[model samples]
Target: MIILGIDPGIADTGFGVISAEKSTFKAITYGTIKTSKADDLAKRLDYLYKDIEKLIKKHKPSKIGIESIFFAKNAKTAITIAHARGICLLAAQQAKAQIHEYTPLQIKQALTGYGAADKNQIQQMVKTILNLKEIPKPDDAADALACAICCAQTKQYV
Candidate 1:
C-alpha cells in the first residue's frame, strides 16, 4: 500500500511517501514544501494547497496520515497551523484518500514505545524502521515519516 504522511506548517510542510507491505516499509520519497514568509498568508496557503495536491496526484496514495495539533505556543501559532492542516485534509479528501489523523503523542508512542520520546529518538526510529542510510533530514521530513510508520503499524494495516 502507498501511504502519504504530512507534517503541516505555514512556512514548511514536511511530507513522506512510503510503500508498506506487511511488516516491510520502503521509503519512496520525503521532502519539505517551503513557502516564503514574505508572501501573504493567502498566497502561502495557495502554494501549499497546490503543492500538496500535486503530491497526492503523483503518489496516488491509498492512505494519508497527518499530524494533529496537540499543543501550540500561542493562539496565533495554533490558528496558523490549523489553517495549514485544513489545507492538507482538503487535499487528501479531494484525492479520495483515506485519511488518518495522529496526535504528536500518538505518533511518538507508536514509533518509540514512549509517548514522551524526544525528537532525536523519533528521528532515529524513523531511520531504523525504514533502514535508511541516514536520518531523514530537516526534522520535519523525519516527523512525517514517523507519522507514516505509525499509521502503517496500526492493526488494521498490519
Candidate 2:
C-alpha cells in the first residue's frame, strides 16, 4: 500500500510517502512545504493546499495518514495549524484517498514501542525501518514519515 503522511503546519508542512507490504517499508518521498512569514495566513494555507494536491496527484497514494491536532500553549498557533490541517484533509478528500488520523503518542508507540519516545528515537526508528541512509530531515518530515509508519503498523495488527 502507498500511504501519504502529513504533518500539518502553517509555515512548514511536512509530507512523506511510503509504500509498505506486510513488515517491509520503502520510502518514496519526504519533504516540507514551506511558506514565507511575509505571506498572509490565507496565502500560506493556499500554498499548502496546492502543494498537497500536487503530491497526491504525483504519487496517487491509496491512503493518507495525518497527525491529529494537539493542543498547544498558544491558542492562536493551534487555530492556525487547525486551519492548515483542515485544508490538508480537504486535499486528501478531493484526491479520493482514504484518510486516517493518528496522535503523536500513537505514532511514537507504533514506531519505537514507546508511547513517550522522543523525536530522535522516532526518527531513528523510521530510518531503520525504511533502511534509509540517514534520518528524514526537517523534523516535520520525519514526523510525517512516522505517521505513515504508524498506519502501516496498525494495518498489520488489524
Candidate 3:
C-alpha cells in the first residue's frame, strides 16, 4: 500500500511517499514544495492547492496522512500552515485517498514510542524505520515520513 504524508506550511510544505507491506516500509520519494515569501497569502494558497493536486495525480497514493495543527509559537504562522493543510486535504479528497490526521504527539509516540520525543529523535527514528542510509533532509520531509509511518503502523490497511 502506498501512503502519502504531508507536513504543511505556507512557505514549505513537505511531502513523503512510502510503500508499506506488512511490517516493513519502503521509502519512495520525498520533498518539499516551496513558495516564495514574496507571494501573497492568497497566491501561496492557490499555488499549494495546485501543487498538491499535481502531487496526488503523480503519486496515486492509496492513503494520505497529515499532521494536525499543534501548539505553535505564533498564531499567524499556525493559520498560514492551516491554509496549506486545507489544500492538502482537498487534494486528498479529490483523489479519493483515505485521509487520516495525527497530532505531533501521536506521530512522535508512534515513531519513537515517546510522545515527547524531540525532532532529532523523530528524524533518527524515521531514518531507522525506513532503513535509509541517511536521515531524510529538510526536516519537513522527515516529519512527513514519520506521519506516513504513524499511519501505516495503525489499523490494518485494506
Best by TM-score: 1
**C-alpha local distance difference test of each model:** 0.94, 0.92, 0.91
Pick the winner on lDDT between candidates 1 and 3.
Answer: 1
Candidates sorted by lDDT, best first: 1, 2, 3
Model 3: which residue pairs collide?
none
List residue ranges in candidate 1 displaced over 4 A.
156-158
Q: Return the number of clashes found in candidate 3.
A: 0
Local distance difference test, candidate 1: 0.94
Q: Candidates' TM-scores?
A: 0.97, 0.96, 0.95
lDDT of 3 by residue, 1-158 (tens): 99999999998889999999999999999989999899899999889889889888888989899999987789987887788889899889989899999999999989988998999999999999999999999999999999999999978445
Model 1, residue 100: displacement in angstroms? 0.4
Instruction: Give a tens-digit lDDT track for model 2, residues 1-158.
Output: 89999999998999999999988999999999999999999888888999999999999999899999867879998999899999999999999998999989889888888898988899999999999999999999999999988887886433
Which regions in candidate 3 have their CA more than 4 angstroms from the true location? Answer: 156-158
Candidate 2, residue 24: lDDT: 95
